[model samples]
Target: MSQEPDRLFAQPLAQVADFVFNEDVARVFPDMIKRSVPGYPTIVENISVLAARFAQPHTTLYDLGCSLGAVTQALRRHVRADGCRVIAVDNSAAMVERCSEYLHSQDSMFQELLPVEVIEADILALAFQPTSLVALNFTLQFIAIERRPELLARIRQALLPGGALILSEKLRFEDAIEDELLTALHLDFKRANGYSELEIAQKRSAIEKVMLPDSLQTHRQRLLDAGFSQVLPWFQCLNFASLIALP
Candidate 1:
């Protein structure tokens, strides 16, 4: 409800640093993500709907890399399974602090909703409980490429039978022409959302070193390698895509 417009990259920068989720980013994340990620609203909203379908009674729902608690709130809003609790985790202290505040706001406005626990910790370091739903929305791409397989395997191991892990990411294409087209279209999407040329250039430079996307085929295969029986892609807007992997 209290989303500040992103102006972090509005000014000219002599050298853009790799992006980090700090207090400044926590303040403007809602605006930045919505404007930057195409169909982000649809993905988050439908994540909740899909979460409702996968949520099992008495199981915990995990929202990994839950910056500002967007997916966390969605899961709380739609999940009706009995005794279900939401655990939102982020490595950034600033993000977890604000996410807790936002979830508290949602709590005041709702009734009999699932309880939420906001944890400030790295997802890979923490021990997981059997979870019914795990939302990894745009979080995995920031992780080190070499460590992704173990991370997915960990998620798969933690998931209960009939549970799922919903992963949303900016995708990369192996095809040269397809990659070029989608990249241009994504830049246009940012332009349409009011990001200026300077802002776009600066932001892209900042995230390029940190955010590394994989191809859709790689994602599906990775999920299978992690022991998930199915990797169902439910949404794809421009270069962004969301997949539901079942264990």
Candidate 2:
């Protein structure tokens, strides 16, 4: 274990960013991300269903911001075995290192399965192949709003004409009543996940300073501006929404 501060849930923006990028997220991530909701199995199942949309035989799957390879693991099981590859990318150095190590150890067991590769690089700058299926799962929210369109365009350029892009996010509802209800329900979820009211309040404040998530309409428009032929919200749970975009 690293001697670093436990910034996963207690630090300010810059400190947490440094810790996330420099320290192994697999070591501290579960305590943070996994605690965002109750019923881990159900959340995993929902994620699995969303990921299955991109799985195909002999295809290259791009997992942008694949923290600790959780989604990658699910994708491997969802996709066909023959010649499939999962290119898991993250800007966090520590996350990349840990994911690479984990994949290497797990590779031999999955010899007949899809190949998983971990890359330490920015999602916006990496070169994506035209044959890849890109998945931005709970990741695009962290990207700056202004850069989303350009990033989407780049992703479209990297994907084949008919390739798919799956994006899941925490969405803001247009209806006031719906928004309030979801917000309360999501908060209840956090509480059920072992967070105290005080902890939840403090964490929300800290997260707002660091994470910049755009509205659902904005995200949809960006995908359209990027030249995707079809873009639609496919699934929703409270504030969470899964969007599918096809090139």
Candidate 3:
């Protein structure tokens, strides 16, 4: 479904605070993400294809930090595993409320689709079931850096044999020159998407401290440390990339 255009950062703010998934963000999230993130639609759609491959019958699939149910709906649309159900979790009430509405719309429109349960809870606190598929799309960067390994280990422990995890995130390049060039290109992408110069600058200021990205090497090592047998990078657009991990 198409979303409204994002104009949240068009005007200059006297004081730009750290970004949060609040009510305003929930309203404009669809537009904000599409314009701000490169290759988002491709990532969201391919997640379902990956789900179809890895989803085991009667096992649960997870969409952690599911905003407005985009990935949840993708799973609902593509997964064919018998008795498989989706559990979508997020901490923001505003996002959950709107996401539930979207899912209800999806339910009425589709038939014989996998069922989904939306929970207004933190991902770190949930007691995970033995899962066949887990999608962590752009969610890990917001988590506390120190807590990331434990989170991945928990997911690994919860995963059934041959289970898969789809992890997508904005990456930080280790090389200073490459990082500078990519950052500029990403900003140019935002400009092309109708974000004003002030908007791009302000948004970056707001999120720089809150969203902490890791290098690809770091992510690979951590996944290995968490017991994943292999890490395969399936897609990369500018600074964003998605990886599939097998346990």
Candidate 4:
């Protein structure tokens, strides 16, 4: 799909509001994420590989906070389990609408891809079905910290035996020095991706109030506490990482 370059923060603003997944953002998200996030393409592709391993017959796979259905498309393309379907959910109306269009486009091109359902609902309030794989790709960070544990516990309860949850997030290192170094590296990465200093700074200011990151230690403990049998780190680049939690 062709994407417009992300220039929302290219110009100065007297006051920046917390970032939102509205129409303007939804329009430019594909470009924005690719430039802002390191290892994003790899992560999206690998989520399908992990899905093929964990997906069970007659169960559903969920992509929570699914933006434009990238992971959902990957899952549909890779997972061939009988009776399996994918549910992609996002609270943003614009995101859901665009995601539906993208998925429909995929459907027209591919034959017998896994069936999918796209929902415009808050994941925190949605009840999950029997699920074999659940993906929270850079999603949990946007959720309020106090509510995260409950959401994980709910996912755990919904998962069938041997099911897995793939969580990808921006990490916060426990050590101040490590945190600083990794953060600097991430900013450098953005610069290298062609984002100007003003764009980087303004974007950071807009997102800082909304996206709160956690250390790997905190994520591990929280996953264990949520009734996952194991929490394993599968991928990491700079301060971003993806984990698998088996239930």
Q: What lDDT is obtained when candidate 3 is compared to the true structure?
A: 0.94
Each candidate structure's TM-score, on Cα atoms with residue i matched to residue i, is 0.99, 0.83, 0.98, 0.99
- Model 2 segments more than 4 A misplaced: 1-25, 37-58
Candidate 3 residue lDDT tens string, 143-220? 999999999999999998878999999999999999999989999889898899999988999999999999999999
Expressed as tens digits, the lDDT of each residue in 1-247 for candidate 4 is 4489999999999998899999999999999999988899999999999999999999999999999999999999999889999999999999999999999999899998999999999999998998999999999999999999999999999999878999999999999999999999999999999999999999999999999999999999999999999999999999999999999
Against the true structure, whose lDDT is highest?
4
Query: After superposition, which runs of candidate 1 have C-alpha atoms over 4 Å from their true positions?
Result: none
Between prediction 1 and prediction 2, the one with superior TM-score is 1
The count of residue-pair clashes in candidate 1 stands at 0
Per-residue lDDT for 1-247 in model 2, tens only?
A: 2233224554334332222344644666655665673343354455556555555556788889987777777777666535778899999887888777767666666745577778889988888765547878788888877787888898888776556888878877777897788889999987776677666666676578557656687777788889988887877767877778988
Tens digit per residue, CA lDDT, model 1, 79-106: 9999999999999999988888888888
Q: Measured by C-alpha RMSD in angstroms, how accurate is candidate 4? A: 0.6
Candidate 4, superposed: residue stretches over 4 Å from native: none
CA-lDDT, candidates in order: 0.94, 0.72, 0.94, 0.96
Q: Model 4 misses residue 11 by how many Å?
A: 0.7
Displacement of the residue 202 alpha carbon in candidate 3, Å: 0.6
